[model samples]
Target: MSIDITANDFLMGGGIKAARFDTIGTTVGGPITTQPKVEQQKDLDTGELKFWNDGKPMMQMVVTVQTSLRDPEVPDDDGQRAFYIKANSLKAVREAVRRSGAKGLDIGGTLTLTYTGDGEQKARGKNPPKLYSATYQPPAQAAANEFLNGGQQPAAVPQQAAYAPPAAPQPPAPAPAAPTAPAAPWTPPPGMTPEQAAAVAALPPEQRAALGFA
Candidate 1:
């Protein structure tokens, strides 16, 4: 834990406000094209690297390309290298963003750099470009909300009250009936005498239960 992190480390860590990486720095192998040759009259010829009478010095140059992450880990290889980043928004050209990605602004390209290194080193390619991925998936609904306004907070659902069957509808009130003229006083058969009538009338309810004659 006593290790100290340099500014380059933070930029390469790739999580925040300043610069972000689209590709990690890689060593693109090949030769560093030396500066073009300038011809000089040899020391009176003989025993010197020679060209024809008008042999302006010529040297063959080899080169390869690779991109690097912002604030990359310095490559251990040799030769001049250029880093490339996929544009996020054209607005990213802002100076703030440029500085963040300018960790190794030492070579040449859109931005020029002078690499003091002797040669290109051996390195490999990163699996994918950073622009190929995103940090998070914002919620779908949240995106819709954002479109409508600025942002949206999820809403809480209300608790529903328990349902009750409507009161079994009330029964209609009973209606009143018309009065009867008096059941004509029941009369026994004409042959029947008062004595007989009395005898029958005196009978107990149980004696004529079928007709309710009590």
Candidate 2:
């Protein structure tokens, strides 16, 4: 008998880091591999567990996601990296998932958390709490062509030209001007003898007017 083991199994032993939102505009995200769970909160300064005034332990939600993003402070570290979500950040993530139409956060989907800004300070000498927003992207659905072709790719469809209105009708060209004829040369008046007209034509302008032949 043979047993199978992978590098990921070994990498999981290194433990996952809780995502940080120490500064405004900080963003962290990746595909989720584990679902959210409520866990007891621990004191950051003493490394000890914490409890409420009523004797119940304070708790927070933990989620594990696989990411390739490297921490700037640990640039040399090149191993499988995971991040855990907690507290109010978990509420933001849940709201994002719900808005995306998902029933709940599921494995193989991406969840991005961003620190937007600080909230109002509630008391003196205490810093304001960081505010966050989240976005969830569900896994991509299979295309219709893939299903119809039994997982084979379909040929590309040709693009059609967009519809355009026909151009306005152009006015008909103006009709060519009718051909014109030249005027005839001046002729002698009716009842006037040609010889008399010739004599009138030879006379000076004042004499012609005196003879009534102007």
Candidate 3:
């Protein structure tokens, strides 16, 4: 295994950071969107492309977006920031759009990205915590009006519907209870005399029950 540094190695060593925002709100101005590019790598020493452990080309689809920070107090790079969606989050965004009935995303159209985390991703500063989720916010008329009225903020984009998981199957309904049958009148045991049977029958139901006669 040979390793060598490229002339642009210094420029390629930076990490991606999440846009700092106070709330989950509409991004200012529509984004300059780009299609996901397939991930690739080259060996600095051999100048050969690398493949995955399975002998297949290691590839990834990334959706990169740049938008304004909603919160004025939130710090951004030159008043804006770029977000990267890859791996599972990328799949989630695509599924979300499909469920919303949109064929695809349009460049310069209003879109919003929101973040949620349980602190694990937040702890790693290399990448914005993988978006808990991403959404396509459609531009609204009122938002357009506000944008045209000298406001830097554009009209609010309406969020597409999120993907809903299918409901789990319910347990099969319980079987119907067996029907009850009427009890026959009690009869005297074998060889019992008429008087004996009458006396036995005259006893309280509890007493007769104790005698095993119903």
Q: Which one wins on lDDT?
A: 2
What are the per-residue Cα lDDT tens digits for candidate 2 across 92-152? 8778978877676655567778899888899999888777899886532111211223433
**Can you give the lDDT of residue 113 in candidate 2?**
85
For residue 50, what is the lDDT in candidate 2?
A: 83
lDDT of 3 by residue, 27-128 (tens): 322343543233445555895877879988644333345544344554544433444444555565677566545565544334445545422455445444
Q: Which of 1 and 3 is the better model by lDDT?
A: 3
Q: Worst ten-residue run, lDDT, model 2? A: 140-149
Clashing pairs in 2: none
lDDT for model 2, please: 0.58
Per-candidate Cα lDDT values, in order, are 0.30, 0.58, 0.47
Model 1: residue 86 alpha-carbon error in angstroms: 2.9
Evaluated against the true structure, the overall lDDT of model 1 is 0.30
